[model samples]
Target: MKKLLFFFLLMPILIWSQSNFDKAEKLFQAKKYQEAQPLFEEVLKSKPLDIKTMDYLGEIEAHQKSWVKAAEYFKKLKELRPTTADYFYKYGGCLAMRAVEVNRLKALGMVGEMKESFEKAIILDPKHIPARWALIEIYLQLPGILGGSESKAISYSNQLAQLSSVDGYLSRGRIDVYFERYTLAEKNYIKAHEIGKSKITFQKLYNLYLNKLKDPKKARELKQKFES
Candidate 1:
C-alpha cells in the first residue's frame, strides 16, 4: 500500500518536470536564452542528471562569454558523453578562452590541454572543419617557443583545401597576409573570389587592395561589389 501511494505521488511531479522541460526547450529554440535559463535551472534542480539540459546550459554560457562556467558544464557533458567530438571541441574552446582570461603562467599550463582536446576532436572526426580551423589558427598565433610554426599552419591549410576549396584559398590568403606575402595573398584571395562571391571573400580582397597593395581602384571595385 505504501509503495502504491509513493508511485502515485511521484507521477505528478515527473509530469510537471517534463512539462517545464518542454517549455524551457521551446524558449531555448526561440533564442530566448535568458528566459530559458531559469526554467532549465529548475528542471536541473529536480533532475540533476539531464545531459541535454546541461548541454543547453553550457551553450548559453558560452554564448554569453562565461567561459569558466561553460567549461564546467561541458566537462560534465564530456563525462556523460565521452566519445562526442563536438562536446570535446566545445570544452576545448571554453578552456582556451579561460586560459586567455588568466595570467600568462596559468595560460601556459592550459595550452597543452587545449591543443590535446582539439587534436582529439580532429582525430575523432577528421572532416570537422571547425576543429581543423581552430588548430590552424592556434598554430599561426603561437610563438615559435610555444609550438607556433608557419609550416604546420600551412599543412593544415592544405588539408582544409582538400575539404573545401574556398576555405582552403581563404585560409592560405590569411596566412600569407600574416607573413607579409601580399602578392601570394592577393592571388589566393582572387581564386577564392572566383570560387564564390561571399561578403567575407569580397571584404578580404577589398582590404588587401586598399591597405596592403594600395590599389585604390581595385579596392573600390571590390567595395562596390560588396555593398551591392
Candidate 2:
C-alpha cells in the first residue's frame, strides 16, 4: 500500500517536470534564452542530473559572455559526458576568456588546463573545425612561456587547409602578417581571395595593401570591388 501511494505521488511531479522542461526547450529553440533559463533552473532543481538542460544553460551563459559560470556548467557536462568534444571545447574557451580578467599568475596556471581540454577535443574529433580554430588562436596569442608557438599555429593551419582551403589560406595569411612576413601574407591573402571573395577577405587584403605595401591605388580598387 505504501509503495502504491509513493508511486502515485511521484507520478504527478514527474509529469509536471517534463511539462516544464518541454516548454523551456521550446523557448530555448526560439532563442528566448532569458525567458527559458529560469524554467531550466526550475527543472534542474528537481532533477539535478538533467544533462540536456545543463547543456542549454551552459550555452546560454556562454552566449551572454558569463565565462566563469559557463565554464562551471561545461565542466560539469565534461564530467557527465567525458568523451564529448563540444563540451571540452566550450569549457576551454570559457576558461580562456576568463583568463583575461584574472591575475597574470592565475592566468598562466589555467593555460595547461585550457590546452589540455582543447587538445582532448581535437583528439576526440580530428575534423572539428571550432576546436582546431580555437587551438590555432590559442597558440598564436599566448606567449612562449605560456605555450604559444608559431610553429604549432602553422601546423594547425595545415590541418585547416586539408579541412577547408579558404580558412587554411586565411589563417596562414594572418600568421604570416603576425610574423612580419608581409610578402608571404600578401600572397596567401590573394590566394584566399581567389578561392572565396568576401568582405572580410577584401578588407584584409585592402588593409595590407594600404598600410603595409603603401599602395593606395590598389587598396582603393579592392575597396571598390568589395563595395560593388
Candidate 3:
C-alpha cells in the first residue's frame, strides 16, 4: 500500500518535469535563451546528471559569452562521455575563447590543453570537420617558436579536402590569404565558389578581391555574378 502510494505521488512530479523540459526545449529552439535558461536550471536541479539538460545549459552559457561557466559544463560533459567527439570539441572551443580574454602568459599556458582537446576529438572521430578546422586555425595562428607551422596547417587543409572539396578549397584560400599570397588565395576561393556556389563561397571570393587584393572591380563583378 505504501509503495503504491509513493508511485502515485512520484508520477505527478515526473510528468511535470517532462513537461517543463519540453517547454524549455521549445524556447531554446526559438532562441529565447533568456527565458529558457531558468527552466533548464530547474530541470537540472531535479535531474542533476541529465546529459541533454546539461548540454543545453552549456550552449546557453556559451551563447551568452559566459566562457568559464560554459567551460565547466562542457568539461563535465567530456569527462562523463569521454568517447564523444563533439563534447571534446566544445570544451576545447570554450577554453580557446577563455584564453583570448586572459593575460598572454595565462593564455599561452592554456595552449597545450586546447590543442590536446581538439586533437583528441579528431582521434575519436577521424572525419570530424569542425575539429579539423579548429586545428587548422590554431596551427596558422601560432608562432613557430611556440610550435606553429604552415606545413601543419596545410596538412589539415589537405585532410579537409579529402573529406570535403569545398572545405578543402576554402581552407587553402584562408591559408593563402594568411600568407598575403593574394593571387593564390584568389585562385583557391574561385575554385571553392565554382564548386559550392553558395553565399559563403561567394563571400570568400568577394572579400578576397575587395579587401586583400584591392581589386574593387573584380569584387563588384563577382558580386554581380553571384546576385544574378
Candidate 4:
C-alpha cells in the first residue's frame, strides 16, 4: 500500500518535469535561450543526470560567451560520455575561446589540452569533420616553437578533401589567404565555389577578389554569375 502510494505521488512530478523539458526544448529551438535556460535548470534539478538538458545548458552558456561555465558543462559531458566525439569537440572549442581572453602564458599552457581534446574527438570518430577543421586552425595559428606546421594543416586539409571536397578547398583557400598567397587562394576559392555554388563559397571567392586581389571587376563578374 505504501509503495503504491509513493508511485502515485512520484508520477505527477515526473510528468511535470517532462512537460517542462519539452517546453524548454521548444524555446531553445526557437532561440529564446534566455527563457529556456531557467526551465532547463529546473529540469536538471529534477533529473540531475539529464544529458540533453546539460548539453542544452552548455550551448546556451557558449552562446552567451560564458566560456568557463560552458567549458565546465562540456567537460562534465565528455567525462559522462567519453566515447562521444561532439562532447570532446565542444569542450576543446570552449577552452580555445577562453584561451583567447587570458594572458599569453596562460593561453599557451592551455594549448596542449585543447589539442589533446580535439585529437581525442577525432580518434573517437574518424569522420568528424569539425574536429579536423579545428586541428587545422590550431596547427596554422601556433608558432613553430609551439609545434605549428603548415604541413600539418595541409595534411588535415587533404583529409577533409577525401571526406568533403568543398571543405577541403575552402580550408586550403583559408590557409593560402593567411599566408598572403592571394593567387593560390583565389584558385582554391574558385574551385570551392565551382563545387559548392553556395552562399558561403561564393562569398569567399568574391571577398578574395575584392579585398586581397584588388580585382573589383572579377568580384563583380563572380557576384553576377552567382546571382544569375
Tell me each candidate's TM-score.
Answer: 0.89, 0.85, 0.96, 0.96
State the lDDT at 46 in candidate 4: 93
lDDT of 4: 0.95
Tell me, what's the RMSD of every candidate? 2.1, 2.6, 1.1, 1.1
**C-alpha RMSD between model 3 and the true structure:** 1.1
- lDDT of each candidate versus the true structure: 0.89, 0.90, 0.94, 0.95
lDDT of 4 by residue, 3-68 (tens): 999999999989999999999999999999999999999999999988999999999999999999
Better model by TM-score, 1 or 2? Answer: 1
| Per-residue lDDT of model 3, residues 1-228, tens digit only | 999999999998888888889999999999999999999999898888989999999999999999999999999999999999999999999999998899988988888999999999999999999998888988888889998899999999999999999999999999999999989999999999999999999999999888888999999999999999
The pairs that clash in candidate 4 are none
User: Residue 52 of model 4: what lDDT?
Assistant: 96
Residue 77 CA error for candidate 4 (Å)?
0.7
Highest lDDT among the candidates is held by which one?
Answer: 4
Provide the lDDT at 206 for model 2.
91
Evaluated at residue 165, the lDDT of candidate 4 is 99
